[model samples]
Target: MTTFSITSDNLFMVSLLFLIGLLMPTLQIAGGQSIGVCYGDHGNDLPPAQEVIDLYKSQNIGRMRLYYENPGALQALRGSNIEVLLDVTNDKLQELNDPSAANSWVQNNIINYWPDVRFRYIAVGNEVIPGGSAQYVLPAMQNIQSAIVSAGLQDQIKVSTSVSTVVLGNPYPPSQGSFSGDALTYLQPIVQFLVSNGAPLLANVYPYFSYVGNTNSISLQYALFTSPSIVVMDGQFQYQNLFDAIMDALYSALEMVGAPNVEIVVSESGWPSAGGTVETIDNAQTYNANLIRHVAQGTPRRSGRAIETYVFAMFNENQKDPGIEQNFGLFYPNKQPVYTINFPQ
Candidate 1:
């Protein structure tokens, strides 16, 4: 009997495969339903920063997004082990456009409490492009990212910006998604920067808006991801839920811009429990619960590749507009959950 010998190259390939298989589960857990909460403090009755941190600890939420650097809140996060996504306001974008100013801002806001606070990302601005604030976005992001690089903190912290669905040009059918108007001019370079930096394309994707805006076209079940009750075909792919459709459309848009490999992060998505039409406690509960389970399994296109997500808000903001804007929170100002939903332990 003759036996064939295994070559060194073949052995190396086998080892690489084994290593990949070994790390897959850990990556899944890290990127899975590691749900985050957006800590928007636009309310007068909300508790103190320390109390809010304690509340998050009790609920096992390991990530949170703060719209700006709040010294008090940053102090509260000391040793909290919560991964934080800190933001720079749009008004401050012009200032941050300067490299020196960006460095100083990072040193003051981020470097001061870094390792202890677990700062993970610096979101340069929220929904700045495609609006009057559009001109400042890219320069601000470049300066911030460069500042982080100069500080030798690029590996620890990512720099990204979030955009709403308003940037898309009729994103239905998914495959035909592309940025139009003035948005295209700004979006291309931004996506390129994200891809080069190995950062995600942060988006605030809300199916609720689609449903409310086109009530005749979108159904409640489809928007809520309750069932594949109405399937919309895009080429050979079948879209059963609005969230996946919107996400794939974004992916398609990235492909159009030559950045198809860039990952996406659903920075904000939630249903208001009151104020808007069809907005109720039951629907909110169903939406969020189903969202958690759906994300845990990943989307069809990105199977086994977890798409990290953060729920829209931590508390109902009384200071926001009286109607729908104030009601997106999973909790009330008193730190009480609006409805029961599962969170990763």
Candidate 2:
């Protein structure tokens, strides 16, 4: 029977070692650009949670962002060393308005399966800007973040909300990005909060949407990121494609409000393969293929930063809206690539 002495020095050493252990994984994530796929299951017909995870591994995806806190998905991804970013639904936004509910939300959903599940980011809600239901999103965001801090998880798990490109008033020129006049009212305070708290501004950008909506106006090659185009320039800064255009839209908006250094991450961006896109299956293949390669081989744009991107989904969700965008999956439901995509090669 050996009873070790408990002293301040011993406790301090233990705490330091624990922190270092925690930082080891963070270092790995920051080692290079990391990519993720959106794991939206608005469909009951998709594979079981665990099987879906296996499918993710089969495709060599290392990171994913889920739309809910369903335990089954968390349970499956727990020991996989994959990063899980969870979202609290817009309807549940009001829950965060109450401290107790917010605390419980983080405890039950976030902290409950922490280190084991590799939950890195808790997306407060999805696309808080455009949705009518997300009107209560600003205050709700504050409350959820308060919960994150209360649970002592803020340092480890980040809190953020995704915004659609609709938030941008002028997204094309990149240098001229601005939040829409209507959305600016709600977004100002939200952006201020995020800036104060060090959360990434997530933009759900889709060139397919831009092109499909304005087919006669824009070129397919530009949307695919493969064609050479004139950079929309403000003096010397040149943005090439929709990706950079959308990002700079937000960047310019943020800079207008004086929070220039706040990090902006592409929470969602992708090209659909299976159906309903004018961009040809070959274009989808080539576009998505090159997009992954470019993202993997990330480099600084004129602003001196490496771009962050997440291709839409791992599998084609049949239960999703029958529209073409709903079919925006890189792989078929059978768990195989829709086309050849060079990942980091």
Candidate 3:
């Protein structure tokens, strides 16, 4: 083999090539897919709306989830090219049950921002199933779908509700996952609504809470995506991480409900950085970084398809009840990262 002599110009090219080679695995892992981050504004010291949007752009975050329609954040998002998952708070579910009210709500929040704000999904309510607000979920979804169709935006924005994993009565073994009687009464219609409208069911899947609730049974390595080998084997599928196991369970639940064709979007998943057991900076970084890399590979039940996932909270909210509720943020309220983690570009 012939080699050229080293010069200043050739040396720079060589270094650049080496750096690219090192980054190739990460780039391939992402495969041009980017995960979303939930942007909660429950803090008193968080950055301004424009600055927060700029920070998202700086990190190449492609999607965002807003818990409600905060005008400042909505205004900053205009023309930002960041896809949004906007939510109508649980309290508003009854109001939206009226079609006219739903239309007005859409007009005020979504219609004005359409084609500019890039809203991809509109979650009608969050974790309302198995609760008092459960009654209004289906009606609100129907009215919102009607309004979207009336506005000719149904093709652009999908409507769904976010449900907590508590809805699942039996979620272990990945195959026995099914909704409890109470949750099924509410979820069956909701799942049908999602399937008919071709919208994915949004589920807030959190392994941190699961592990915290049953620390003796759930290993930290498995919860943090560091398990050396498969921890749970169900039929033909093998699960090494808690996230995939939970997702496959969800898929099984949907299939039992006769909605196997419907997709599931992970509305929120995260580990805390402090204020609780096993909640450390290193664990948070490891969890979030591995999440960004793992979601593109999908779950065992739905291999090769990228799972649409959103990590919870852009910043830790000091206003939340003191403890883990305030600690799920990947970044601090001061616009600094709580731990070093890479997002897919």
Deviation from native of the Cα of residue 337 in model 3, angstroms: 1.2
Writing each residue's lDDT as its tens digit, candidate 2 over 1-345 gives 000111112111101011122212111233123677788776656678898888777656677888888889988987887787788887798767787888788789877787788877777777766557566787777778888787777777777787777777665455666777877887788788878888877777777677666544555555666445453444466545555656666788888877787777667777666566453456566555555555543322324456566667766777876766556676666566566553430
In model 2, which regions exceed 4 Å deviation?
A: 1-33, 229-231, 277-279, 296-304, 342-345
Using TM-score as the measure, what is the rank order of every candidate, best first? 3, 1, 2
**C-alpha lDDT score of every prediction, in listed order:** 0.78, 0.66, 0.82
Task: Tell me the alpha-carbon RMSD of every candidate.
Answer: 12.9, 15.2, 11.8
How many residue pairs clash in each candidate at the backbone level? 0, 0, 0
Which runs in model 3 stand beyond 4 Å of their true positions? Answer: 1-32
Sequence-dependent TM-score of model 3: 0.90
The worst-scoring run of ten residues by lDDT in candidate 1 lies at: 10-19
Clashing pairs in 2: none
